[model samples]
Target: MTCSATTRVALWATLLACLLNSGCTGTRYIPSQGQLASPTPPPQALKGFDGNARVELNLPGGYASPDDRAYPTQRANEDIQNWFADSGDDLTVAVRNENIKDSGWLSMLPYILTLGILPTWLTTEGETVMEVKSGDEVLFQNREPVAYRSALSMLLPSAYLLGSPGTGQYQVMADDQLNRHKQALQQYIQSQQKDYETAVSAGTVQAYRQYLQDNPESFFRMETLRRLSELAPATHALPFHRDNVALDNAYIVYLPDEYDIWFLGPQDMKVYDVLRLSREEDETLLASRIRAANQPYKVFNGDEIALLKEGGLSPGLIAAMIDASANPTSVKPAAVAPTVTSATSGAASPGTPSPAEVTAQPGMADIAAQCAKRYAAMKACDQVPSFGANVCRSQVKKKYSHIACELIQ
Candidate 1:
């Protein structure tokens, strides 16, 4: 019940330490005079950092995966996300390798505790710098100090110190940090949109590919895809033979001008014209599949066509058929029946006999003379007005003499 002065002092110290929650109170941030190095990501690389009317984080140059737990940006990002959790904000930070820093306390802790030297022990602090981009513009960037004060804090638990500030000043500090990054993210997004417009007006497929691929999760992904689709291959049906059967059923037949002949079989469509073997028949045979391994196709113009037939026909009738097709009315007229005018006149034969030694056969000269006299009488005087002779008189003289003679002699 009655404690000494030194013992009482020790009791107070114990209560104070307990009030600090089994650990030293939080460390505070002082606005130091030094500047943090700003990130210099290319415009395209920063595409998704500001979109959806909200701020996004992109650290492609930071930790590649959670496997890189010691990465400085990753560590800082975890702190910021935890801080934002209470604010109902979702914060996701992409990681890259360069974000693994050599300056973080926990990273150095391994070397310090492992080496156990005075200088290593003295190195109890780390600095973190992040750019808060709105679009393509930066709002605030500060390289802040972080202090570790736990037994295991030397090699671990750096995140607890990253987003934390001095005791009794959490709301103010967290708000300050959030606002800075939010502004920067918004500015970055606006710049990105403007750049996208300029690029799209005169854009190429390569540029669109870069933007779309790099920022696949960007808010403008659909828009980017629209532009990309313009450059992508169209996905429609090509010139395919649709709803058709038997590609080999049709043939383009041709005839060249050369020989006259009836084109024989393989009749399909009858062509009406003079059938002349195509002068190109030899060439055609040479190029045909029957002659060569492959058939190199050839076209026959209208001029080369003499006939078109659908049925097999001989070469002999081809020329005749062509002529008939060309001129439909070249047939001779039919004969007419003759009328008998005199009973003594028999039907005349459609034949002629020789005039000289002609009217008499060798053994029938007398009968021939009698017939010639009758024939000469039947002839009109107009047949030989100057000599009082006619074609029949000449015939009668030849019948009497075996040689042709003047009618008067």
Candidate 2:
């Protein structure tokens, strides 16, 4: 179909115009750089962006249920008192207001729904103060007895004692409550000590050991150990031999001390049974027993070790536990493995600087001076210890040990 030049030119022009207007052809898709205009505003407010919005921190298991109403009035009073004590002054009212306003569940309900239910009573009255006198002397003055009672109830459950106001009392009763509580605890400890003595006198070591083994979680462990340490023999014969020395059980007996020695049972079948050796020979004999047939052996200090031993742990495990117990600000768990060296032999050698020794050792004065010279370099010494003249000695020794071992091979 042959067309005139003017007609062809006109058709091409129309096609180009259509493509440009539609933005459908010959268009590259480049992402927009500038701010984009939204068709609609954001559907919901972003978290933390709602600055004026109220925040509610709900109780763990929500409000008490019908089953909890057995001691309804008392429980409610206790809860109110606990809240006041913890929040400190006017907290009950503030919390109630917050709960009503910010709670999503409460807001969704009809206004009439709140009117149908009885509202919880929260006392707004400031702490009451009272003053009292006995004869010519003033015994007590205006005191917030309720607040103190509430605080004590929450802080110490067993220690809180209820008291009745005396005749014509204008002030809260002042009794020796703290002294009474302390006396009660002391009495209990004394009673426990007597019972422990009786148990020791009446039973054999095996019986006592069995009692300890069975009731591992008993709070009496420390007391029992104290008693045992006192009763343990003072002297031993050389090459002392004891039958059925329960190493695992002894671990449960004493708390870990610096001088405590753990004798590990042999690793292989041909190796000897494990024995725990103390600094004192007699104590070792007391703890040891002749190896029994068919007794199970553990590779690492397991639950058995923890259950029996005072520290109930191996040297490696004890070191880890000690590191864990250190203050978070002073010590970090991640740094423990790389720092502390467990004493495998008699004691860690003085010549060898353990990871702990390395960390604990202070930087040299020269290093500190060099660091002080530069404003940005002040904290550089904290990265590693700067030893004085003895620097690099350990490193060189370690290298030599490796070389010597290789040469001998």
Point to the candidate with the largest lDDT: 1
Candidate 2, residue 344: the lDDT equals 16
Query: lDDT per residue, candidate 1, 1-409, as tens digits?
Result: 4568879999987875343223222223332243322433223323322222222222122111223223333333544444231222112332222222223344435534443221121113343345433334433344434322212122233423533323322223333333444445556556767866765665775665565446533434335544543453333211111101011100001011111122111121112111233332443432232222211001122322332222222343333333322232322101000011011112122333222211122222222222333332334212322111222232233333422112222
Q: Give the TM-score (vs. native) of candidate 2.
A: 0.23
Residue 89 shift from truth in candidate 2, angstroms? 28
How do the residues 245-310 of candidate 2 rate in per-residue lDDT, one tens digit apiece? Answer: 232232222322211122211122111222233222343232332122221112223533443243
lDDT of 2: 0.26
Query: What's model 2's lDDT at 230?
Result: 44
- The lDDT values for all models are 0.30, 0.26
Give the poorly placed runs of model 2, Cα more than 4 Å off. 1-175, 210-219, 230-339, 342-409
